[model samples]
Target: MSKIYQLVLHALGIASFSYSFSILHSLSKGESFFFSIHVISFLKNWFMVIAVPLEGLISILYWGILIYDEKLLFDKPRLPILIDLGFHLIPAICLWTDFLFFTKEFRKSHSHIFYLLLFAFSYAVWIQFYFIKFGTWPYPLLSKLESQQRVGFYFACFALCTGIYHMGAFVHTIFNKSLPVPTKQKDKAL
Candidate 1:
């Protein structure tokens, strides 16, 4: 049962990652210019949003089970959850803070942080290579910004991912701890 559950969760994760990457790629290509017309329309009309969030919820559920078993989730023998939480929380904070205060509003969700980090970092590196090769960054933010600013933007993205991850972990911990334990079965006289 656990294996089946893990398989399903992993499959969902992969699907979500792929869907998100397609959207990001589309944005980079200027295929979708307007924010609402792009993301909202895609999410509302397609399977990305629902599949991605559902995948994340399943992943979190698995993590919660692990944490419940040991009262910790990060390292073997139960390292502080905070350490793992930091991994997710930092990125999430950076991404949101940078965009919200500096750049345009980008929808930040805890569900997409892991995949976003993976996609963004790889995509950013690829964009850098493209810029080196053809003198053009794929995305507007990267194209318009100075090198230092772009690097900072990447770091901010990392922080945002970490923030969202930690938030999810913390919430899972709280919920897991608060759940009612099942009553023990009383053995009757044979």
Candidate 2:
């Protein structure tokens, strides 16, 4: 993958996570802000929905491919252990935690899946265009595959990512149900 492209996506996920965290912190401290609560909530939720699956896909695909074939992912000077983990693991974990715990449950809809497909399609276009210009795919594995196989690979990724997104939502539901969460209670007369 292009370093710049990877950086941009990572930066986006990190920025969204930071923004969501700050908003949560402010709410905890009872701080007033410029934006309405609803607007803030909407934006944060949308951001999480997009970022969580993206980061999840990155981590999932990276580790999966690494295990399957290391040469496909890295060159002679491999990334340091910490740097590799930082890039491929931490963001997914952090974003998944934030999405599952901090945010309210999002309404599950077919539209969400559509959005994911749209993202996948957009990325496919970018990567293919890059390959056309550069005369090589970004990842060694991609270059090795036949064109039909590449399409199948992309479909598999889309399926896996969609599963990851739904799995988080499912787990979130279970955790919220089984745990004792704090809520405001009315005072009774003494």
Candidate 3:
């Protein structure tokens, strides 16, 4: 997919989610429907919620496919292979295609790294909250690991997100050399 297409998809996805939440907020309060900036800002963390998916995809591929025992995956609830692919593998493929193909227009600047980190940190907080509330780890890999190990896993996730952002920016700069940067210019002298 082209970078512009990916960016449009991401932006549309965010707007759609924000709209859905805003409608829910207004409806819950018996107010007329409107997209509110105050509400969106209040719920800003909900935007660009891609890092969690990235985390899941990365952790599963690294732990489940790369290092874990085969039987662990084969055994148990016996989820169909297609289901796993749908949830995990397919998104990774899409993310890669979005980053790798026709992406000269999508150069992530250094400031963008913070966006990835924000999501990663927010996700870690959410996971910690969920674990505390449920007394269960959401994933088998985390559940099996010790507390120290789990912290290491979270650290690795942060590192992975950071590396991805940096690498994306570097690739953008390198691959997009021939592409002209769009800039806003003043009107001609009147």
Query: How much lDDT does each candidate structure score?
Result: 0.47, 0.73, 0.52
Worst 10-residue lDDT window for candidate 2 reads 22-31
The superposed Cα distance between candidate 1 and the true structure at residue 27, in angstroms, equals 33
Q: Rank the candidates by lDDT, best first.
A: 2, 3, 1
Off by over 4 Å in 3: 1-67, 70-75, 173-175, 179-190
Residue 56, candidate 2: C-alpha displacement in angstroms: 1.8
lDDT for 92 in candidate 3 is: 53
What digit string (tens of lDDT, one per residue) describes model 2 on residues 15-118? 46655644764475333666666666777776666678878888877888888888887554567788777777887787777777766646566777888798
Question: Candidate 1, residues 84-114: lDDT per residue as tens digits?
Answer: 3543333334333322233222244555665
**Candidate 2: clashing pairs of residues:** none
Query: In candidate 3, what are the lDDT values of residues 84-135, reduced to their tens digit?
Result: 4544455455444444443333434554556666766776787788788778
Error of 3 at 99 (Å): 3.0
Q: Give each model a TM-score.
A: 0.35, 0.80, 0.55
lDDT of 2 at 144: 87
Model 1 has a clash total of 21
Candidate 1 segments exceeding 4 Å error: 1-121, 175-178, 182-190
Task: Give lDDT: candidate 1, residue 20.
Answer: 53
Error of 3 at 179 (Å): 6.6
